[model samples]
Target: MTYRILLVDDEAMTKRSLYKILTGANASYRIVGEASDGAEALQIARREQPHLIITDISMPVMDGIELIQRLREDGLDMDIIILSGYGEFEYAQEALRHGVVDYILKPMKQEQVTLLVEKRFDHFMKSRQTAIIKSQLIAPISSAAERIGHELWIANEPGMRKEMRSLSGLLDDTEFMQEERISLLRDAASLISNRLQPQFPHQAWELPYEGQSYGQASESFAAWLDKLLNEIRDKRNWGKRGVIQQAIDYIKTNFADSELNLEKVLAPLGISSTHFYHMLMEETGMSYIAYLTQIRMDHAKELLEHSDLKTYEVGQRCGYPDYPHFTKRFKRQVGLSPSEYRKNMQQA
Candidate 1:
């Protein structure tokens, strides 16, 4: 789906330059409208309901801050990015307080724009997917599966119960069939089973209806899912092993991120680089670099065989933005260059 963007700046040049920069960065970003002032921007925003709004903080009539406040009052949940000149740091700070996602200084750099836009959009997609998971069964379930895995990884029994209780209405509502719901849940669980220890066994996440049916307010269904999550959490084992598993899971989920690295992975887990490396090697019998390389290479091979993405694009998605480096690594790991691999697979 094309993500719509709205540009708000009094200067025509500013809007023009930003539009050029944005559309150049990604083809999927469609600039829906441009407004000169904050009030005009607000009107376009309401009419369009854009996914992202890039607005200057110092527009006349209705300043960006006031516009943002008005948007909140009107219950608009648009993601915002503020544009500010050198002295407008205070306005940017206030914007951040109001949940502006990020700010860009005047004269946007190409590298910075590409990085920030992709990062924010990636997060926006993830949040959108989570909202879908909460509302209904998303088709294929792979998009929402990682979220379920993460939730199950962290949640204990009581917390899982409370979280699943929010979905009790979905469980009880006749709007969705039980088999459809269970099928979605099972597909998500199948994706989640990858994070399990080598011996958690099969059918662990299945809902048991031996004694109860959906007639009982779906309380049983909710409780069963909660229990299943907690059991998975226990198997994940929030110890040093859990840290390693979390790192592995992060690697698997974010293999596409070209900037992901050991420091980034361990930053949230509160573990040092040396410690994590050693622990990962000792516990899993696989070095951190080896595992990351294997994961990326596996994904690279899959993309080469299954999709028609360009070799460089395939490399980028597998965390190797440098084409030469990616080619070198692919040849070393898979015994063929990416293009060669694709050619062979397609021919076969």
Candidate 2:
């Protein structure tokens, strides 16, 4: 299949050289667009939606690391090759962390670039096939499990062997339900839980059902099973949440860093500050700044209630350099001054 590629570099000659080399190599490849810096590159990326992006690490408006971060944050799955002239280990490490498909040190040789591109393209295809298999398998397994669970509920015949066989098939399916799948699994669990249990623990009836022999499943049992499955599904589905969770995790881990802010968070992720703000608001129901403020305020409140740290110290610990500003925000969120909040918690 033909692939569209984007070439982004600050230098005009670099862009021209790569474009010429790639377009000359094969009829299957096309140079879709070029950009001067990270910001323009992002604009082109959004517009072109290329299969592959080649970018330089150093640029005036935005850098390659930031570009990769932005694309990933936007949930774009394009393969990327990061180029740099400086051979900076830190830049390569940062690029890898944001999931760049490849990194190339500049003084670019045509053969080296071609080899890197070929490898990444093959890897991308394999990954895509795996994802497809996983998507197709989830529903059938879930349906089979539900059907078997229901059959066991109704039949007095020793069905553990049959049920186990069905479960084995179900487990083999790679397809998993996402959020709505959890609801269906919960319903199936409920169906299993409401059935009655056999009294004697025969080898066949020794199937584990709430620490008893199972004759039938009950509603409570189903709810319990549903809860367990839901937890598993939620954990698995976290990657789908994308940048919102990434931003939240970063904030949680680095909130105490004095320089932590919207710019710092979005820059590393390679997202434009504007788009980052919008996505954060959509996912979290709060603007980036407001979220950070809330995090700081929450931390301050905890320190006020649990620790001997003074309010200013608490503010500094939560990324607020200004003590009065921290106090003002804390009071706004908690409806009490730091000292008063602490006093009330102690009294209570």
Candidate 3:
């Protein structure tokens, strides 16, 4: 992957030289922006949202340590490297405390800097890939358990009941490899039992069969199973109130796209417009439009606080067709307009 870098140094010549050397050494890397001082570096870092920052220890306005502290406070995740001419132990200690990835002395070789950056980039990619695989495995295991729970509700046979009881006992075992799967099954069973509490006040096996025949018992079990599965599936569906969270994840991945909307969102879920709206409200406790507005506003706040994106560009990136609407919603949610929020954040 091509990594974006930001170079910050008080000397224009030093910054230009370092940028040229780094870019020439690695075609896979790009110097996205350069800053003359620490203050300007922070602005460029936010606006460009570079993957990495290389900065000098001493600079006018804001120093490297202060910039790192401020970036951490704002929750920016860019990696930082500090450069200094003198070997000051105190400055190195401070940079380490602020979680800088590397500290290099001035008059350093170009090869040494490039090697350190490449190592960090490789580590970041490996960790992210591992997390994605783990999440994928958990989802299918949870879904399969939910299906088994639904099947048990419909069967309600003596043998199946015995199996469920056995399964519930094994759920707490530390030795089980499929712990998430078993926990999901236990949750589904508990939910079904809760739903039938009014009718079958006692345990499932203890329910009285006063006027009911065997066929009625079977029918009742089938109906209950259908209702339970529907409830689970509805809550799990991405288009309903759950869509609020889905919308957040979607926006995070596609925030750069300027035309994201409710229609495009509904297309993937394959639900009717009316049902989609109601489900979104039920799951998220807000209308579809309201939820979408909240997401856009929240994203605007992040950009205003962390990135140097102009207010209009931030609004456009967040899917606000009108800049005025974006400003209005941002003010309503954050208690300040976008520009005002940015000013307050910078001041703090």
Candidate 4:
């Protein structure tokens, strides 16, 4: 990722020199804006919110100390580097107290500028890595626990197991040490326990999972979750059948409506199109349209054999709005046109 830097100084020459040094030293460090004074720097900071700000201590307008204080007050946590001359040590010390990362002495050499920026970049990268690792471990555990709650509420055992597998898979994928992995799993188990505790007060479980390997802890947690879900399923009455089942029922009842479609049918079920499609395939061994067509064709055959309704009326009753298309679909599925099938059924 490109790190943005804002340069602030009263002297145009100093700002230009700093820009040249940064551009030559690091391609990833981009100079987003320059300000002649700290007041202008604050204005640009509000707009740009640059990753780093390099500012001179003394200027006509609000100086670096004031800028840092204001930015802190505004809750903007930007890394700052103060520029100080030989006699400005006291100002540099003040900048440090105000959370400046480092101060650069004036009459700065290219090497000095390059080294300071490089060190700041290194610090930035390390901080980012730490945040990433922390988030990676924390977020997935919360997500997995939340998923467990949702699946349990829906009385979906398979979905619950799927979430458990995902939780385990997350631990497997991380590059954490054995101890760290164990700790992460323990944390996850604790979180999951908290979520399920209110529901399963008697079955409050604890994991002395410290000495256990990552795989063992994961397996233990998965088994415990499976048991908890089973207990929940046995106790509570859930909502109308799972989303896919509700969708299937909707299709069956509305099959004769020519406008009945995947989108319209599944919209009320609140399942995504892809998920609805896959569930139809998995549960019924056919795509949604294919299953709907099978139902329509079967019902059409019943109308043809038993009812006195004409073949066109049978087609219309079975959700085929267009006569030719209805005839085409009937022939394709039943190996004969509707009229021919009716005659054969009558002869039989």
Residue-level lDDT tens digits of model 1 in 1-348 = 688999999999988888898999888899999999889999999999999999999989999999999998899998998888999998899999998999889877767766777887887787666555544433223423433343454443443444354344334442444554555455555665664434345344545544333454245445545666656556545454677768877887897888887788888899888898886665444677877887688678767867989999999999999999999999997777888777765543
lDDT of 2 by residue, 1-348 (tens): 667899999899998989888878767788899999999989889989999999999898788888888888888879888887665778888888887877878788999888887786676666666566544444434433444443333221233334444544443333433323333344434434433122111111112344331212223334443443344335335347577667777886788887886777876687788887776654444677777776676567557766998878988999878888877878887677877777765543
Report every candidate's CA lDDT: 0.72, 0.65, 0.64, 0.78
User: What's the true lDDT of residue 74 in model 2?
Assistant: 89
Candidate achieving higher TM-score, 3 or 4: 4
Task: Provide the global lDDT of candidate 2 against the true structure.
Answer: 0.65
lDDT of 4 by residue, 1-348 (tens): 788999999999999999988998888999999998878999899999899999999998798899899999989898998899999999899899989998889898888788888998998887677557756456446656666654554456776787777667677776666667777766776776676565455354455545777667667767777777667656653343377768766876899999997789977877789877876665544688888997788678768867999888998999998999999999998788899877765543
RMSD of 1: 21.7
TM-score of 2: 0.46
The prediction achieving the highest TM-score against the true structure is: 4
Sort the predicted structures by lDDT, highest score first.
Answer: 4, 1, 2, 3
lDDT by residue (66-123, candidate 3, tens digit) is 9999889889988898887776668878898989998878787787787887887786
Alpha-carbon TM-score of each model against the true structure: 0.42, 0.46, 0.44, 0.48
Deviating ranges (above 4 Å) for candidate 1: 135-348
**TM-score of decoy 1:** 0.42
Error of 4 at 155 (Å): 16
Most accurate candidate by lDDT = 4
Q: Which 10 consecutive residues of model 2 have the lowest summed lDDT? A: 198-207
**After aligning candidate 2 to the native by TM-score, how far in Å is the CA of 49 from where it should be?**
2.7
